[model samples]
Target: MKKWAIYVVLCILTPAIVKAQAVVADSVHMTSKKKVPKVQYGVASFYHNKFEGRKTANGEIFSQKKLTAACNTLPLNCWVRVTNIRNNRSVILRITDRMHPLNKRLIDLSHAAAKTLGYTGHGLTRVKVEYLGKTKPVELNLMEQPAQP
Candidate 1:
C-alpha cells in the first residue's frame, strides 16, 4: 500500500516538474541570446590633415588613407557601416579611435572613408551608423603551423 501511494505521488508530480524545468530552460535560453546591434544617426565629419600621423585612442597610428573612424560611443576595434544620407553612399569602417569629449558628431571618419562616402567636400554630412559587432581575432590551425621548428 505504501508503494502504491508513492507511485501515485510521483505520477502526479512528474508532469508538473517537467513543465517547470522546460520553462526555466526557455528563460535561460532567452537570456543567453546575443543582444541586438545598435544604430545611430547624426552628422559625421572627417579627420583633418594635421591628424594624419597621430596616435589614436586605441594606440594605432591615425592615417587619413585608411577606412577607420573615431566614435564617441562605439567600442574600439568594432566595425560599423556609415551611410551618407544625402547621397545614399555607404562605407564600412573600423572604429579605431574615440572622438573628443565635447564633440557632438556621431562619428569622425578618416579622409579616405569620407571620400568613399562622397562627402569630403561637404566636410560634414548626415549619416547612419550601424554597429556590426566586434572584429574577430585571427585563428591559427595546426595545419597552418610552421611544423616542428
Candidate 2:
C-alpha cells in the first residue's frame, strides 16, 4: 500500500516538475535575446468607405482621410513615420488602430495617408518606419529612415 501511494505521488509530481522546467527554459530564451523591432516594407493598400466610420481596434471610428495608421505591436496612440522611398515622401501618422487580423504587414494606413505616398495600386514600394517613443495623446511625428534601394 505504501509503494502504491508513492507511485501515485510520483506520477502526479512529475508533470508539474517538468512544466516548471519548461517555463524556466522559455524564460531564458526570451531574456537572452534583445528584441529589436524590425520594420517591414511591402506592398500595402488602404481601406476606405467599407471600413471608414467603423469602430477600430483602438475603440475609435476609422476615418479614411485621417493621417492615421494601424500597427501590430505598436501601442495605441504612438506615432509612426511611414516613408515612400520612390518619391522621398513620407507621412507621419498616429497609430490609431491595431493591425489587420489576416495580414503580416507592419502597418495599415488610411486612404489619405497612402495617397501621401502616391501609392494607388498593389505593388512593392520601399518603405521605412520608425516608432515614436511616446503614448497618448499621441504625438504623430518621427524621423524618417533613409530610403533603401
- Using lDDT, give the best candidate's number: 1
Whole-structure CA lDDT of model 2: 0.74
What's model 1's TM-score? 0.66
Where is model 1 more than 4 Å wrong at Cα? Answer: 1-37, 136-149
- Give lDDT tens digits, candidate 1, residues 46-119: 99899989999999999999989998788789888889999899887789998889998989999999999998
Please identify model 2 stretches exceeding 4 Å from their true place: 1-43, 121-124, 135-149
Model 2, C-alpha of 133: deviation from truth (Å):
2.1
| lDDT (tens digit, per residue) of candidate 2 on 113-136 | 888888856534667877654552
Error of 1 at 54 (Å): 0.8
Task: Please report the candidate that would top TM-score against the real structure.
Answer: 1
Candidate 2, position 32, lDDT: 70
Instruction: List TM-score per model, in order.
Output: 0.66, 0.60
